[model samples]
Target: MALITLTSDIGQQDFLVSAVKGQLLQINPSFNIIDVTHQLSPFNYPQSAYVSRNAIKNFPDFTFHIVMVNLFERKPQQLLLAFHKNQYILCADNGLLTMILEEKPEMVIGLKLDSNAIKNTLYCAQIFGKTIKDISEGKSLLTIGEPDVPIIEKNHLRALLGDNWMEGQIIFIDNFENVIVNITRDDFEQQRRGRSFRIVFKRDEVIDKISESYADVSEGEKLALFNSAGYLEIAINKGNAAGLFGLQGYLEQTQNAYLQNRLFYQTVKVFFE
Candidate 1:
């Protein structure tokens, strides 16, 4: 049986998700549908990419990973079907494909309107459902539509290098409220060069050393660690660090042109001695 994984900004509360699955079953009843997450923050590309990147690799090869977040970014007329590392990924052309994959996919094909089994559809479920049905049935990607089309590009904020300091930003806050920083462990070690450093964020909150787990600190104490994704994470032992520290995930400001200059929601600086 073919496995299909789904990740979407659409909350699990409504019947819309089920309706899409029902359509898939109507076309291919043998498809093994699994969900990565349906609680994604709406249109938050960084968060979507973060979760998608971390989760998709665990599944076996040949899984059709469907990402349904921010489907209508300025009303994209086409959807993306990409083959990368022996697996298939589908999503909107919302500049997130570049951010999520880091590199160009091995092959990419755009879904065509003619391939859509349902016409004049407004919701993503209707359009994507039909295209995915065609895909599951051995339809050639060449027959799908245009190939190697220009993908929208977007880059994440990187840790800024300084003489005795590295500036980073909060990339994501997990369900555990652990604040994931943009600084990877390799980046920190390279910049540290064997010097002592302090991670300073919000006012008066500081973590001096990296811990392996929450138990490394006492209950209710602040600790910093590198998460599974290899990014620096700050958390309070058995507590909600984001709420206590007033730190937030990266929020892209797309409405106001002037606000685009300032990108990140919260920033953390590591000062070394």
Candidate 2:
């Protein structure tokens, strides 16, 4: 049985995920369906990308990955079936695939499915399922879909560095309220360079001092540390940092302005040195 993994924003409380699984099983009863995660934050591209990138390589070779987050956006009509490093990924033509592929794909075919014919997640069942089944049965990728357009390029998030400082935006915030910045451990170490530095968040809120581990600080105190994934994180030991500091991840000035007009809190800013 071929292993097909799913990663999506659809929560398990609803029938959306189960419905997709049912459809896939109907197509090939012997196919093994795995759920990498269904609790991904809604429309959170960076979080989804991080989880997908970390999870994909652990699965067996030839495993088919189906990404369904933000798939219905009216950006452009393009479907991506790509093979990289012996793994297959089926997703929309949006920049999601571009962020994950470490190297260029061997082939990228644009899939055109009869959108009107497939209802709901059945699009995946009919289109992606058929493709996976064919590949499992020893068919060429060229037989599935026609080439439509070359992959679109996207600008990556910027990382700015100075002699004694590095600036980066928060890329993800987990359920624990830990903030993961785009800056890596190497960036932090390079910027510190044997000098004392502090991490601040949300308009001069002294979120943390440098700490090697959570236990380095007293309970309820915030700390800046390198997480297991080698990313810099702002977290409160055994407490909710977001709630304590009234902070949310990745706020936009436009969104804050709308909120401020309604007597809500103003913008948030982060600084590190």
By TM-score, who's the top model here? 1
Per-candidate TM-score against the hidden true structure? 0.88, 0.81
Q: Return the TM-score for candidate 1, rounded to 2 decimals.
A: 0.88
Which residues of candidate 1, in runs, are more than 4 Å off?
A: 114-123, 126-137, 254-265
Clashes of each: 0, 0
Q: Write the per-residue lDDT of candidate 2 for residues 68-97, one digit (tens) a residue.
A: 876776544657798878889988776777
Error of 1 at 233 (Å): 1.1
Tell me the whole-model lDDT of each prediction, alpha carbons only: 0.80, 0.70
What is the Cα-based lDDT of residue 271 in candidate 1?
97
Question: What tens digits encode model 1's per-residue C-alpha lDDT throughout 1-273?
Answer: 678898888888978778767776776788789988889888777778888877788889877888888876665667888989988888888888777787778999887554444432234555566666777688887877689887777875567899899988777888888898878899999999999999888757778999999999999999999988888999999999888888887666554776554443377889999
TM-score of model number 2: 0.81
